[model samples]
Target: MAPGQKLYPRATVRKVVKAHSGCNVSKNVDVMIFLDYMLFMQDLMKEATIEAKQGGERGVTARSINKVTKKTLSKFKG
Candidate 1:
């Protein structure tokens, strides 16, 4: 799985449940809840990553503008 990929395919759920079969948690209810929780978390993480990326881009633009303004002010003063 590549970094930042949030796709939680059914195959993954099946694998997890199969791996945990010895724990008596292979029931439909338990599996459904687990899958739902996993999907919810994945969505939250995806949103957070996207928001952070957008904020970072805005920060870069703000810094660039600040730098240009400072340079212009310095030139005017000199």
Candidate 2:
């Protein structure tokens, strides 16, 4: 991913949040949403890398991700 590139557009995120909560979200909320999920995904990938290394793999593979997913989700449960 490139710097400053976003997976989800802020306007779309705001719209989805509003649709779910029936309340408008501010710009800050949009930023926070992006930051929070970005951090979460970064953490998830880090864990997957570790899992792959422990399993003698060269990269993060699907098996590594699947193995660590439950443990990772348990950490970030909200």
Candidate 3:
């Protein structure tokens, strides 16, 4: 993402979920899902960034993301 672009917050995601599902989630569930999602993305990005650097990319470009996505997902899989 570009500079200053914000990730979706937990409240925003909860609102979206409620809009789609027509039900409210408990606060604890929402927070747990939000934090897990954030942490997963953060870890995935870190792996992609390292791959990008190894590939001589100036930044984490789409190529780097695509290259690392499958491996990252497998690593993060439960």
Per-residue lDDT tens digits for candidate 1, residues 2-76, read: 999987676666667767664544436455767766765555445545555666753334444443454444443
Q: Model 2: per-residue lDDT, tens digit, 3-71?
A: 998677777878888899898788777888768889889989999999999999989999999998899
lDDT of 2: 0.87
- Give the Å shift of residue 53 in candidate 2: 1.1
Q: Quick one: best TM-score, which candidate?
A: 2
lDDT of 3 by residue, 1-78 (tens): 999998767677788778887977775667777687888899889988999999998999999999888987887676
Lowest lDDT 10-residue stretch of candidate 2: 5-14
lDDT of 3 at 73: 80
Error of 1 at 52 (Å): 0.4
RMSD versus native structure for model 2: 3.9
Ranking by TM-score: 2, 3, 1
Global CA lDDT computed for model 1: 0.55
Candidate 1, which ten residues in sequence have the lowest lDDT sum? 58-67
